[model samples]
Target: MSLAVNASTFDQCLTSIRALPDGTDGIVDNHGNPVNISSNATAISYGLCKEVCGRDSGAFEWSVFSQQFSAWLLPWLALISQLPFGAKHRSDNVMSMLLTVGSPVLGAYSLALTVLNSQWIARRFSGFKYPNVGLAVRALSSLQQVPLEVSAEYGVLASMVVLPENNEWWTELVEGLDYIHTWSISAASSIAWVVIAYLFTVIDSFANVSENIQANGQGVGSVWLWLLPIVIGWLQVSPKCDFDRVAQALEKANRKAYLADYPNPVPLSHKTGRPAFVLQHYRRGSVHRDEESSAPIFNYARFFPWVHAVEQVAEAFERASENALSHVPVGRDVPWAPSDVGVHGDNRKGTLDDVQARPRRGSPIGRWGSDVWTRVIVASALALSLQWGTTGAAFMIVWFTPTKGLGCRSGAYLLYGLISTLVWLIMLLSSIFAHYSHLPHPNSQHLHLRGVVDETAARLSVALRRIGKFVATLNAVWIVVICLFQFSSFFDRCYCDSSVIGLGKRAFYTLLLTEEDIPVLRGAWIGGTLFYYLFDFVRTI
Candidate 1:
């Protein structure tokens, strides 16, 4: 069971031991030559089990900082920040301009994380850099304050009040949009000068540092893995709207006159006032709804509920199965009765979901609330899925490194991440287009409706609303695809472990590494990933 510390010579020794006396050893490397492994790898594996991970399992902190934070959440937050406050997608505005020009925060934070985690950067930066529990909680509270992605649906209603042919509301928005742009442009230009003049070399140095980690396989920065997520927590403290001011402004602009002017804000008719400004807005070369506010962007938020529901159900079944295993009668023990716990949980979830789904009889989620919730749910799922999916794909990229088809893995993952993102728009547009034929359909409850901009916004709005289910389903599919690929691209687990684990040492010695087992190991990896998603998919449905 004793493992030799001299791992460097392990592979060569294994190759010799595995070779049969008559030279019939059949294992080979990627180049394909006779090799040995049958007796060889087993010795090394026994040593690993005896040394590192004994049969007994133990507690390990979730790698939210190292694997999850660095791998996914960090990059995802950076991407989301590029969008304007309360906006879902980035439009051609000052926000996008700022993202392009003064994105030093992005570069700086990314560099800082890598540097902090760099074991080679010196001893100073590499260790337990995450904030304490109290600080992290306060920092996280800032991100959760406004819930821009959730509140975005209110944007449609807000837009109705905020946008008119000639009103302060409309002027404020346009001004706000431009206001952000002017300052952002100015700041970006200033940053660009410094970047051009001095920081280019620093940028190159950072790239070299990153390459060093990737090339030899990022082993150094194990100690300082928790900082970036805390930083992301800091980033979440987005600018919030003062609801008190909003109400005050509403009071100042007398309700009746405000409704008369911004009639569209009132979901139902005012029992008076002119019809909404559908004809007027479209009549001239005024800003198109798509340009001003891509309300459809919020439509995808519907998947949030579905994703939440899916997770709950999956957890439910997983618990049920685990409980069932624990309760199983061991070899002629007395019979056990089925537990009602899982059933009760399911009933409660279904009851609540159905109540919310109906949106009538004083249900909060009915009607317009339902529309908002649906998109919020879906958008949330997509966001999480994108974060995890890209993270998974990145892992896949790292896995394939130093193998024969390394370049192929990079190409495959590039396509995977890009396609997964674009899929949202593709399915969204397709679903909306399909729903167009349905016409002015009744929303969730078939409640009596208003027809202000029905001729204009109704078609697009209804299509967007109806499209949520399809996109939600598609989101589930994309999640499984990326997770499965991630698991499959786990091609180098043994190789990476070779630095320490005895099985890895054995594999390296006997040529029994992942590249050799691709044919059969692929099916196993796929089955495992799908099995993991199965509970999720069933619960979602």
Candidate 2:
């Protein structure tokens, strides 16, 4: 006779199985097939067997296979459904596009900046006076002297260019100065992008792991362990990117040089008992004399009153001699003259119009509201809030979820934090090397010791910069690889029963339900990333 068991008899069956002796005869099926129960069979194995043999076996298997699959798929479907009806899809699409497109664009932009800065630095110090000095030493010297040189040379060259008659060298010098200014701004922008991208990656990685740990009931350390790098890295790198600070520094340097160039006349006497003359005039005359000393000496100005007269006479005589000795075609030998007044009329008129229109541009408050520092402050606040909110949410989820594993997630989370800390440390070391390298060589009685110290610092700075560049390049490549892996894993999770992209993606996405659960975090992440790209782009321009 066939025996039928209902839900109430299921417990009886379990009891009978548990009571059966280890060496007893096994039960037989309807077809008279005998099945032996092993002594090693456990309650878990028996339960699994019942599950497999149950009428709902298909549902049970599907549920087991679709744990992570459904977790992501449902949200994806929801997102897709909202595409035509809501702004949610638009934002999601934009984020996805940025992940796919903006990353490479930013990477290429950074690479270009790196190349340009490298070329500029090399060219800037290529003319070091001492052949014995290494390139690193020259670079350090150039960096240290950049403010002074830019301030002094820019004003002088600019004045020459503004004059009615100027040489090609003056124009080129002015252009070179402009190039340096542009490069400084670009360098600052590049560093900012690097720091922002780094923080973005760290936050995203933490959120990914957090979701998994929370869902799986795993205990991990505080999120501050992950956030500490953000604070430290920002403190180290943000000053480099502050446009206001850079601008103020440049302005102060220019003001100092300007003052030095046109200092107030102070009465003084020469120890040799020469007449008290305007020192500025004396210094200018001496410079002219030194420059022309190789040529036939002109009658030296004996007194202060005779200086300008003597200079004019000497310049005229030299010009006449040069003309007599040189030969040139009549057309090409035309005397140099300033351009006609009419030639600059359009530019002058435009300048006047621009001046007149300035007042109408905006109110003082509006201008202040649009200032660079204002934007920076606002962006920073938004980014910090986003980071904190996302981290807090993750913690809250973990706190409420029933987790079985207590410390399993800590190792991986700490590993990520450790890597970030190491990178920040490298960056800090590089900054320190750069600072020391640019310091003025100390005045000491022991010249040899001073030289050795300076050279050592320069070499270390050079090596550190190279290392930093390599690390930045490697980090960019790593980010690209991670992005690709994530994309592939996303598709694999949706289509395949198992992840085909390897265990890295499998482990990463195991607990992550969706891109993000909170709308604010999802939007903030996208906005913050795009802000970095936009900020860099604007700075570059």
Candidate 3:
């Protein structure tokens, strides 16, 4: 138990260490070489870990931001859900389903919108930025407001009103589809979380919910929590009818613009001898090319200089080849010849010389046309709403029904929603900050982007500053508001007498819930949401 002193003894030990078995010392193969496997195992393990878990973990983390907003908003949603806004309508199946289903969809849509509008505002102008929250919300409201431009001229009109061909209903249905496309990523994500929570409960159920209940270990709810969202989502099946109609109208508008650009495009060749037609806009050509002069001319002397130089090169090559190939004693069949292989390359440039140019195509209308920004803002709003809605559902499931088997699963879906929302939010916030930081000061600070566009492109210098200021202000405000709401919600849930803990203590205790783990759970919720948003922000670019 004591120390052994003396350098002599230590020296002897060191000597023994150096005198290891010959094979062990060198670790040489038959040829006697050193082997270093230190990095090999490390590399392998790192690769394995990345293959098995890294992707999912990264994905989970990225999903957190969208959830964060949801986390903040869930308490409000729960309170709203519990409110007696519709006593008479509560029992109505459609109303019940909408509140249950549509609410979350809307939340997710809002989250998506927040992100997208922010991004758009960021990308559209050089400076003077804002969060576009007002814009996002307005866009969401716009789906209801933007009149369905359906006409009886389109067959869709027939489908909107009367039963199978009900155009009016179809129009509304299209509006709803637009709504879903805008927001449902988060909604679906929340449902996915519910599935996970349900699975966790299912696993715990194997041990005994009753015993666990006695031990306050009651499992969460069934995985079927996910099923409800999916089922409810199915009601949106008819929404495509609306999308098809809208898309068709937009397409028609594009075609009209295209055709207007080329009323007759007839050939008007003069001494210049330029042809004005191209393959892309080819019609049954009213103007024809002169067949006699169509043949292209080539300069054999300049182009085939390589062919002329080949004889000199061949002499050297032939000597080398004969020396190399002849060295291989040919007792066999035919030997290889130079002419057996001929090289070819596309060196032809003659066609371009006399080629006549056609008129340039009209300016591109982009993937979407004039209403592109408006559509984008609306879409983003929908995404944000859906994300929020899902988070709300998850929070309710976990907070109110912590004993239910699907709470964790709900949490999982909430996590996914959080991620999607976060990405959107970050891009938005970046754009806003960029806009505001670059805003013009003093006399020009209040000037809008319109003025900047109209006055001079140079005015954008100030506009950029405003945009940056807008973004920074927006991000700061959003973060602060979110924190306030979150804290408020937590305080309400924790301190209130009618809180989940107070009223449901018996059930909570039965499920073995611990007050100590509350912080951890909340942290997980917020962290996950944040992680997701940050990741998605990166992805949006």
Ranking by lDDT: 1, 3, 2
Report clashes for each candidate as comma-separated counts: 15, 1, 110
Superposed model 3: Cα runs more than 4 Å off: 1-357, 363-371, 374-382, 402-426, 429-541
Clash pairs (backbone) in predicted model 2? 217-403
Report the lDDT tens digits of candidate 1 across residue range 254-274: 232222122133321343333
lDDT of 2 by residue, 1-541 (tens): 1111111213344445445665444332211223356222222122222332232211122332254333322222222221111112243233322221212222122222223333433443344321111322222222221111111122232221121122232232222223122224434454444345445443643464433222221111122222222222222321122223323443333232211011221111211112111111122212122111110001011111122222222222232223222421111223433234312211111121221222211122121112223322333333334333323333333322211111222222323323333443343344344434444544568878777876676566456534543554454344333323322322122111111122222211111122233343344334533443443344335
Q: For model 2, how many clashes?
A: 1
TM-score per prediction, in order, is 0.31, 0.28, 0.22
Q: What is the C-alpha RMSD of each candidate to the true structure, in Å?
A: 25.8, 22.7, 32.0
Best by lDDT: 1
Give each model's whole-structure lDDT: 0.29, 0.28, 0.28
